[model samples]
Target: MYDEIFETVVQITHHDYAGCIDKKGWDHPAYFREQIATRQLNDQSFEALMQDYLRDYQELHMGFRRLEQESQRDVGFTVRRYEDSLYVTSSQQEKRIQVGDRIVALDGETIEQAAKRHARELKASHHEREDWSGVLLDTSEVEVIASSGGGRTLALQAFTKLPHTPSYKIESVEDTLILTMTDFWNHDAITELIRHNEGRFQNAKKLIIDVRTNKGGSDLAYSELLPYLFKGSHVDLRDFGDKAYTLCTERNVDLRVELMDQVLQTIEDEKTRHQIDVMVRELKKNRGNGFVELDLSEIEDNMSFDTKQGPEEVVVLSDVFCGSSGDSFVETVKHSDKVTVIGRPTLGMNDYANVAMMTMEEKFQFWYPTSKSSAVDEGNGMGGVGIQPDVYIPWTPEHLDKDVDLERSMEVLENFTHKGSNI
Candidate 1:
């Protein structure tokens, strides 16, 4: 019976690649179970069948075709390479093109005609079009809106809404600066803030880094900011496990050693140094010579409160959007005595995901951790189980509209400072 079911699945997957209608929804376990129940397959038979089908599909296509489709759909971008720039267009926008004043489809169909005809069209756009020579332009529903000074703004409300400029706001209540970052990866804004606060660092009694909406981006940015917090100190911030490290050092051991030495120099405290050395030695013994460890101990041990010029206290504000490298930043700072973390728990997707460049296919693919991140606080691994905060602050719909997360964080910082004064 299991063999029969397995054979059936294989037939459905292989024989009907384009029209595998039955197997389309089988990527979901619940849907597959419903189908199995409808077909009246027994538990043992169904389990065996699914196991066989999964293994066979993985061996042949690296993973289930249905799953791959689902993943691609979820990620929502199809990447292409032009001469100079990387092109990433959504599957929903590919059918429509925007001409000067009209939106038309690639097949010379109007935007309305394309939408009415196709059930699901790829949302794609040309990213590297130097000149509009070979590119097709579509313009059907273009509206010209006149500004206050008589300048006309061409608004193209095609598949997506019109792009609006984001509002920059700063709410200063007492000594707290509540900065709400809508986009996590905007380096310009972050750099500007760092520069703006360079003077504040010396004067401010307490500094709060609100990364509530910071989803994560550019690990380099996170690393760069560490110097400001740690000054000249170095500490190992993370370990990428033994196997991964060995692979990293296969090309050069001297580079790895030099890197490790550079990292070790950041540790300012002798006691912390001993702890780091012990951990490194243990890792070396267990994982063998070639693993990379990020040293961030210098920042942890050397943070001084006695300095009249430096920031007296540092607080990190977190939310569900905080993940990946943001989580790493939180974790690294949490180890320090000068920093206190407030607000809700993080998004908990803490594992280091690697991007694989498929040279043969000229594409990039990402492989995230199947195993839980050991670097995180024990048992609080990925898949929605995020890091618990020292203080839990829940956000309501009303709070969101009024921007209450920052308010709550600031209140916490103030209260913490006031309470510490009595002690």
Candidate 2:
């Protein structure tokens, strides 16, 4: 398992975006290989060890697609890491533990200590990680200290499947419309939502898009919303004037073929199928080429869309949880003169994108980006730092009960809500 993973990281993975790979001088992999060899680990334990090694990259672009067993599961609550302390952002499972509560300890160890083993170890502007306090924790109890004072031992419920959250939600506060998109995964669903509420969107003076928890899917998922949010006629995917540099290896080309097949099987949309067909053909043409530069500056996709009238002004609510296509949406949308990005920076998975998968011996499957961004060499890349918001509203304990991000948006909109009408 170690050997296979090491080869993938060292040989297969393009060492452009993940600065850690070069920073370490590739010594950690060999060290981890030796360390794992000392232990007699089963499949679950093996992947856990590999995951720990993978964490060194600090890139969400790479991960395990399929596992031998359910090696990682979460305690169905949400926590946000502030400095060294872990705060409960949402307490869905433990009613006793409020949103402002601080997680003192998990099992017996301090959150700082437990997070290394239980949660993902990542360093970013806001390092939010999976609350891997075990599937049910060591014991179904967590030591949560109240924000005001005092502490209580609250119970937790772990989940193999996370609690269901809707793809998109639309709300109106007078002329202002709040579109809360949980994720861009539901391409058709998001498209439908936009089409369904066309009148409400067009009539709005201000649009507040909440993508704080969106993990991202196909960039095309939020395509329909682009026209509404965009204030002008044109917006490009290469908002920074960088071409999408896709690495065309045999593996990557094969993965594109696999993706096309999957799309053909599941997707009924003629346009989507045609897009996939085009992508596969392009990849096939560039097979064995080092890095093929795909010019997205003039691409006619929804990403590089021509705008239509809807909301006059737009405000996007983003957090560290948002990444990949979600990050892409924010990056592209921010280019518009009428858009203001609020909340926190994204998870920073845009350094490398268009992720593809590779299975080794049918034991484990590795997921990695098939494309590299031109921003990597340019040095202005949204890799580690992510897309910084214009009006930075630092997330706080008050954010739990009150929609601090939304409130800030409302406040901003109030100052200049009905100044003009054109989108």
Candidate 3:
């Protein structure tokens, strides 16, 4: 029976973010009861049942598409957001579709309307422009109209290459360091990049950390970059004046307890060990509190910086693609007076974080957000709204052709350097 999947989803969402369920209009007890009966009567497979349920939950309700398959196939081109419109930025070896083509229509809907639909399926910002993976497909064909007013229909297998991007990039423009953080896939890659480029970073007068296309990977990746950003004796992703909480089923609680116990055993430091012990104690103390207060940031007092390295003035280049850890990175740095955010708002994905994977029937796996952003208490953490940039620079087709964001950033740096003006 698919009862386990329904029960687990209900329990998790009910405890974690009942508001999320309510927003979907899936909060009706009788509705779920009826759906359960239908599922049993129909004898639905776990994958089939959950995919349909989550498609409604994610795409219809949340405004973002759910990724069901493991591997992704490309449509011979890449689409980027240019103010709620999806534009073909790059194509794999110029396969049919050329660059600078705007996706005007997809499956009979206008590109703008489809972009909104795509944006709804996202767990991050509701801003339609932030969704970089425009119109993903498995086996279906996507019809698009180019910016040049030409139209063509293509399938997923049309792309000769895979949907791929580099891990990270470091470049030097005059005295400024243009650090392009595309993905946070590897913690070690971040560490190695900093380690290998120590000299270049030290010589730079200003730094522009471009996370425009960063879709977020590991918190550990951003944590590794902290020492460079903050020239302190220690670093901490501390509580920014809010009480954090996590909602979990008894099964999740037990798993967390087990993991905590295992981690506690591995820790040799007396002070650190004691801290973990206290955390475990408090978690168990709260037990069935439904939403128990928890610290989401990792506190590391031992992580020391070079002090002499890194620039005093930093600017973060953000857009709709900057989400999850990318959004969190922006939130962390925006607290500092030295950093100025440029370009569009970040892909606001702070709410409903720390996804926990649940498996049913030992085959179907479900990913649920066990905790929400601390900003939820402040009435500012909706998945649709992103963090606004200090300097609001929206991208255009002209800007894309001329690399306007980079040019504007360099101009700002030049003015800051010569005139001593913050602008």
Question: Please, what are the lDDT tens digits per residue for candidate 1 over residues 255-275?
Answer: 233343554675443444454
Q: What's the lDDT of the predicted structure labeled candidate 2?
A: 0.70
Total backbone clashes of candidate 2, pairs 3 or more residues apart or in separate chains: 0
lDDT of 1 at 302: 29
Give the candidate number with the greatest lDDT: 2
- Report lDDT (CA) for all predictions: 0.41, 0.70, 0.62
Off by over 4 Å in 1: 1-172, 179-196, 227-309, 357-383, 421-423
lDDT of 3 by residue, 1-423 (tens): 457657766665555442464345654545555766775443224443444455444421122122333322346666765564567777765467777876655666665677556653334443345444424543255566676786787654534345556668898777788899887755556767876888777677899999988877645565545656654544444534334466654655665566657656654545455555665665576666666666423433422233445676788898877877788788777765567888888777667664545555654555655555567667877356677888888677776478787778888777788887677
TM-score per prediction, in order, is 0.44, 0.85, 0.75
Native-vs-model 1 lDDT? 0.41
In model 2, pairs of residues that clash are none
lDDT of 2 by residue, 1-423 (tens): 566665665565444223333335533677777767788876667766666776666667877634534544566566776656568776665566667778777667775676555444534434443433332344567787888899877777654535457668898887788888878776667778888998888788788999888888887677777777765567665455456777777777887688768757866656666666777778788887857775332235755767777877888988878888888888878877788898888777887788777677677877777776777777877876778888877766677678888888887777665555322
